[model samples]
Target: MNIKLKTIFTLLLVAVLGTTFCFGQRSNIYIADKPFVQEYSIKYNFTNERVTLNSVVSDRNGYIQVLSSHGLLRPKAGQFLFPGELVNDVQYRPTSDKGITDADIYKNQIIYIDDKAVLSNAWAGNLYSRHDLPNAKLFSAGQDFTFLIADEMELNLLKDSETLWEGSLNNEIQDIKYDSENDHFFILSAGEIYSFSPKNNKLELVLQNDKLTCIEVAGKKVLAGTSDGFFEFDAKSKKHISQIEKNLPWPEITTIKSVDGETWFGSTQGAFKLEKNDKFSYYASKRWLPSDNVIDISKGPENSVLILTDAGLAKICRKEMTLFDKAMFFEKQVRERHIRNGFNATVSGMTEGDVTSGSMETSDNDGLWTSMYLAGEVFRYVVTKSEDALQNIRESLDAMERLYTINEIPGFPSRSFERRGYKYHDKKWRRTEDPEWDWKSTTSSDEAIGHIFAFSAIAELVDDAQLKSKAILLIDTLMATTIKNDHYLVDWNGEPTTWGRWNPEYVNARPIMVGDRKINSSNYIGMLQTAYHFTGKEKYKKTAFGLMEKHGYLENLMRPMSEIGRAPETADDWSRMLSESWNHSDDEMYYCGYWGLYRYAFNDELKAKYKEAIVDHWEAERPEKEGLWNIMTAIVGDNDYDLEEAIWYLQEYPLDLVNWTVKNSHRKDIELIPENFREQTIKEVLPPDELRISRHNANRFDLDGGSDGRSEYSAGDIWLLPYWIGRYLGVIGEPVQK
Candidate 1:
């Protein structure tokens, strides 16, 4: 065959194999269609300062009732009733009765006790049973109208408004719970746990501990809470079932309850639920509660959990959702509040974390963030062919195009742009030739690589001829200018920006251990390969090869990840600083550049090497469970790149994007480790909701951070990009039917 015909035939063969690989085995490759818990919270603050909440219960209708020192109070909903919706109008309205001290839900009936008598709200408000109880503190109801009431030092058993048996204890009573399966009531005090059998009229000590504070009985186990932690005992054997569990979010356990066969604990610091695999889903801070000091917990309306705190009540609701469902919800979130002049932006300066009180703000890395969002939309358009996705791509592409034209330099893209006087206070802001506009300077390599990644995706995947041409032109403009200026992005001041220099002199100066050495080589070569692939330009191809063979760029890019660490003591100051810790931003830059590096390799041999490098880096990053990085690694057709963890990341991320203050450094459940070069603080990473709101550039292992709800991050770059990209790669399936 002629050389021309041979080349065409090879291209056709590659196309056929690519199609087979992408769609043929898609059934086995996609994310499983399983439901995940999506949690959100609704909080109601105290109406008055005098009401002291003692206990909480919910009836069959899911109406929440709180027993306080003043009276029975019902928390009325406000105009807005959805989860994560904030309204100040929800108030605890008092009932006609007063001086109620204890309450319980007995067979869907709300029963109450006061200083004088026991009352049942089950019989048309006329079921008052008189009793000689004084200073009633707590009560447990049993079958056939049997009640076990306790005071500070005494207990009274009443049946049919008559005294059945009375007993005394050595210490102050704390709580009481009835075990229906065992036909007995378990009593908790400061020193001991006792079981009272009404049938035999006997009270016997079951367990003895001075620190016991609360008690709960579930089927065959009895759980007792204490100041240090909690202990479990077998109900049938009356012996210890487990040791004291000190590994908790907070150990000062104040209350414990079993709701829907799942255990929930309330501590002085917050509340947490015991999930499968011995993990606790921590609910603390203002994001999930009104205050961290939890008083009680109960099942609430619509399969929610109600947490009573010193300041107010919090209702945590969970909805069943798949990854695709979450993606669509985040898509709406971005379009509503995060779009600023077609650039994905954050809402900053929010007053006390109120979403309605914030305004969109420009950022230094707007170009990078917008490029990520644009690439996500292009992937969405490719996967689903949604018209809305195409429109989003068009709008954001316009914003990206303006980044080049807004500045005076021919191929330099601005960091961001704003009105002339609005951003003039910053030293990086410069007046454009246009009178009404100003453009940000000092653009970093992060923005440069992000632009190339988005442009390459558009040039290869988008079907629009005009859009594809524009994307290729931008790539040529950027790469040509870099080559013309000795591989440096020249600013209007005729100096190279600090981070945009990838010339051999600067890149090769860093020690091999420093991440910047590897990342810069990888990014620069990827850009050259992408340019040559799209534009068919020999200059880009030649420049890329010359750097690889002569300057050892290929060796630098192919260095194993395990060998990259802190610089030697004899290294330069800049190299030492760059290697002092793992630079998470470098991770972001590397993955963003991976799209071009792996997809547009110069030849099959280079493509195989790129896949090895990408997979090696992913192996080191497995501890983080970062969805974006894991999903991006799937582009190399590896089936074992922690796909389950990727899905877990998407599912576990909180629906509320508000930057509420979150702290996990004080948690007792997590296993802390010695400080290392990777900066991993614990043996395992906390879920996304338990950590602060952050973008892909932030370290996931950072224990505590936030602005106390002063800003809301955009979901466009944080969530939607990874999700849509996963969908486009056939690693995540469509939304499953309910």
Candidate 2:
């Protein structure tokens, strides 16, 4: 049950994140496959792959020049360079200096040197030195003259041999920039902003603060990058007005730049953009960048932003598109990247895999994972009427239905299936005595939940009579077998499976405090209702109502979530279940069973009670910010759901399907909730990959990690279920076409 339920939510999440409704404009945040690194020996090549990125600027000819410690490297004979094509190999004479101190693109040429200003055309292999300012530390190009800050505590503005303006601030300057509006050369010295106006040949202190680390000018405002984020100061008033760090996702702001009027923030973690509407968007982590550390940023062609990081350089551009376009892209990638085939087994998609190897070991819950895939296709067919979706539904349903007939048992579903000679360590595969195939037994309640959930979706959504009949037969057979065994799934060994018990004696035996009491109660009636609905069998309906009236299953299932955890004393029959922490498994069972409980209710009165119970369960789950639970509650329709929050979950979901090791245990950014039964913590949910492969019921705050930083499992059912449910419920409409 643990493996199956875990895989359902896990697989659904890792592989497929479709188009998200606009947070206004539909934009894609992506990491380039090719990073502008010295390793690539392209525009920013150094001696090796690793090098410090000092600066990046675009020249008048639209050529991008990147300055690094090794040198100012560009394409050999043209503007474009491929990875591994080194500077020397591309050009006979690299033209760039052996070592670069500082550089800027000035008037269609690279103006750079350690101690002199060399105006060089990289592609044309032309170089000219116009100034020899000894001990020159840094320089920025102005309209006619060049501004240089020397290590000898001197600031000089010169054109040719003529000195336009000269002054000494008496403080060591770290960086220098030209503000065209005021004609002031802003000097970052001693963590202060000092301006030298060549027009007036005078130096004046503009702003001083211990934390002023960097500076840039946009429009009439002087932007100061500091510990508190970027400070916006009016150039005319010279008074700080506002700080733009309110929406910064990462701290340790490193550099700030205005890209065509948009505020771009570079930090030790990643880069962020503060849009005009005061909202923030994040472009961070290895998935979105070569490295989290962003050192510098510059304007690129067509409003794009160029970013320089410790590992490489990248460009981010926004285009006008729709969510549906992205959804099609996602679908294509998942089909190409995630699909895997096992020896003699049906073709199926992996929940997650190694990004490099592109292979994933089979999981124990293949049945459940395949069921989710089937259900997703079912929903897709319902919406788009796509024949391909119908075909995918058929294939996935075949894989799921095989779980029943693969073994000798008439109605029992196998946990998974494999080839005859397949080798494994956890459990020996039974031969089924069928020479061609092998199957796993001891199916749990989670398998049943997945089977019934998927079959119900297919039977309800698909129009094919044969498929509907097949689903109904399998559901009825499974339900009748459970009933025949006193509401327990007695395995081939004639013993009840660990989680498939719903007998009144077992369901009613546990005290109200035990999680299984609520779990078994809800599933018992839910399963009975499902069987009755599809089969229209009086026996199934009679048994469902009888369980409610006789065993108080409705009351048991409806216990307030607050009172559902461990009580003052423990029972011998429920010793392991006795814990202060709320049981996540119980939550999974109740919610998974909610569909059967409400959708196929015996009557209207019982349906109302089920809705009330669902509302209470959703309220208890609100703090988790779980997209699945929230979307499931929307299906119940008892309360106004958080539609926006649900959309945020889908939108913020990372595109990279690989489960990279993400460590947030020691992060101070995550808010910690006071310790409670369910172990709730974190005011905001972390990225999906950062989270453990847990069922929907697990406490969002349960802090557990594995030694291996790789993700081998995913809760795909978690995503597909809610997305399909939303589509079916009309909460999410057809995406806008291009």
Candidate 3:
């Protein structure tokens, strides 16, 4: 063959092999082809002190009108336009010439009821056309200016200025809704559902249940909201279609309505949308509503849902976004407010969730957090070849490098560093030789393992020689120091930090059931393997084997996850305390170290063993559906590692990372289990948006916690790390095109 043709043929053959390999490795997990809907709130709080809102409606012109006890009120836009920003400037200005009691949207126009008449803006210009009906309590408007007006005892149907029919019922009327498809009105009294045919001018009883509160009609279906739950009925048959839907975020149904072919329910506790899968997307608390007491629901502008509560109005907006799109948003969020001296940090002490009023705070896990962020950027750079990711890597790597140099201890990384005299009341902060700075001491094992995880990733994945060498040197320094000092992180004071001990004396001292024994063993061996892999140091390998064979470190790490539980009562106070419940932080440390332990094993036999241990750990962690842990387990080439659950975690995570006060302990739907060793609070975990904004180190089953919007967490380690790593591992695919 000619040289050009031979070269092309070789390239084609390589490409075909690569494609086959990729398909073979592709997980059996079904990833959604379309983008998921990300929901957020745009709140319009109650600002008018003189008026109390009763009912709300939205017109096709995108105008929202509320019926207050005094008059009709319309919303005025707020100054701030950002998503998730609280719009307190929305004033409900009076738009009616007379006082109004109730209202509904009829043919894209507002039709309302007053003490003396039923009025509408659908007739002409700005003037409302009225049909006299005294003591109107409730009303609904149908096609061609037809109206169904109801009082306590009387029901009146009117077409324009002329009355079509009048009827009386035994029970007091509660609500009225016009069904365009059936050409009739579904009426709800205190206990009965009646279908009134306007064409025949007759009212016939459909069903009777004492618990019924309100009614709605969606095409051929009739929905009745009861005191306990809601019921669905076939409109044509006028019979119940199925059992009452009691499985909801909250029962005690208050109202029901259909918007854009979807049924929405308003309850005493919250508002929720009935999804296509027969599940509910719940909206409650301050995150999605002003109050839990939802008085009404309607369709709003731009594919949003307007929920009226006692405190104000909440516009739940839906936007179509892929997981990659969400990652980009969180990327901006981190760089804008979370980067503190090149280390990913938190914004704290905010005034009522305002991001601007917060200050970046130092943390004990600064090294671990910065390392996770750096590793994420490494994955991002490798996958996308993004210059921004490369720049981020360089900046964060500089911060990680300084952690060792900032302190006199050879490889003991400082917890954090800051300007001298800036930190207060913390004795852990010590003055460095440089008069301008202070470095924190008492660094823990988590920081040590996290540093190895990131440094080894850079040393192995990054092509830049200088960056690779720097990473390897850090690994060597840390592992050398640990081995030299007898498996402990010795501080400048010549004493091992409290939680940094990995000697057999400490590891074997704890009961076998304690998680510390396994976690510490796992981390130390991983660090040794990583050190040997990157620096080609034989001592690292020799020491790792010694610990594994002589010290029983391998047995400890390879112990079944089911065996971990509360330490024996005879054990030390520390061991007992550590095993009181599952340590989610240990889960984080184990997954982070697994990158090094499994990838840089001494041989294939140990690699297989490490994969077994790693998968066992992942099995224990499956209930949390943690994205990072599951995606990290993909390194072992498992066919199924809960990839869908991991995707759920990534997608369900809220875009607003502010530490809002989220409460779920009071919820009635979730089944609470008795407190156990794993600390699984409920039978099922709530979506991330319903829980507090927490890192992977926090328990996903934690039912309730927050700083009441007093802080915001960085998304770098919590979200972006998993997503970028997932993309790099090819467990998660690229963004789907529109």
Please report the candidate that would top lDDT against the real structure: 1
- Candidate 1: clashing residue pairs, number: 0
> In candidate 2, what are the lDDT values of residues 1-738, reduced to their tens digit?
475664443333222211111112211221111111110011222345565567777655556656676666553341211212124212324445345577765554656655655445554645444454667768776766455544557777766645566667666787777777877677788767877777677777887877777888778888888766678887766777887654456556788887767888888767767766664556654334456678888876554567777766665544333333334544554455444331111222322223344354455566665666567667767777889778767766777777778888778788777677764634535667778777876777877877787777766657666667667667787898888888888877788887778888877777777767787788878888888777667899888878888988888988888777665564663534545577775666666678778877877888888998889888888766676677667656634466555655555444443343344554434566777677766666664534544445456665444323244333245455566555655565555443
For candidate 1, lDDT tens digit of each residue in 185-230? Answer: 9998778998888889888899887778888886789999988899
lDDT at position 15, candidate 2? 24
lDDT of 1 at 627: 94
Query: In candidate 3, what are the lDDT values of residues 1-738, reduced to their tens digit?
Result: 685664454344333321222222345453643599988777777755666677778877787776676666555553221223222223432336656777887777766777666665556543344555567778887777778888787988876557778898998999888888778888888799899988888899988989898888887988888877878888877777975645677778888889999999998888887889777777877677778889899988889888888777888888999998998998998999999889999999997667889999999999999889899998888888889998898899999999999988777899999998779747689998999999999999989999999998887776666677678778878888998999999987899999999999999999898999999999999999888776666899999999999999999999999999998888889988889988989988998999889988889999999999999988888888888898889888856898888899999988878887877786666789999999999988888988889999999999888887799999999999999888878788888968
- TM-score (C-alpha) between model 3 and the true structure: 0.91
Q: Which residue pairs collide in model 1, if any?
A: none
Judging by TM-score against the true structure, name the best candidate. 1
lDDT of 2: 0.63
Taking the candidates one at a time, how many backbone clashes does each contain?
0, 14, 0
Task: Specify the poorest-scoring 10-residue window by lDDT in model 2.
Answer: 32-41
lDDT of each: 0.84, 0.63, 0.82
Pull out the clashing pairs in model 3: none
Tell me the spans in candidate 1 whose CA falls farther than 4 Å from its real position.
Answer: 1-28, 47-50, 76-94
C-alpha lDDT of residue 302 in model 2:
51
- Per-prediction TM-score, please? 0.93, 0.81, 0.91
Q: What is the C-alpha RMSD of each candidate to the true structure, in Å?
A: 4.4, 8.4, 6.2
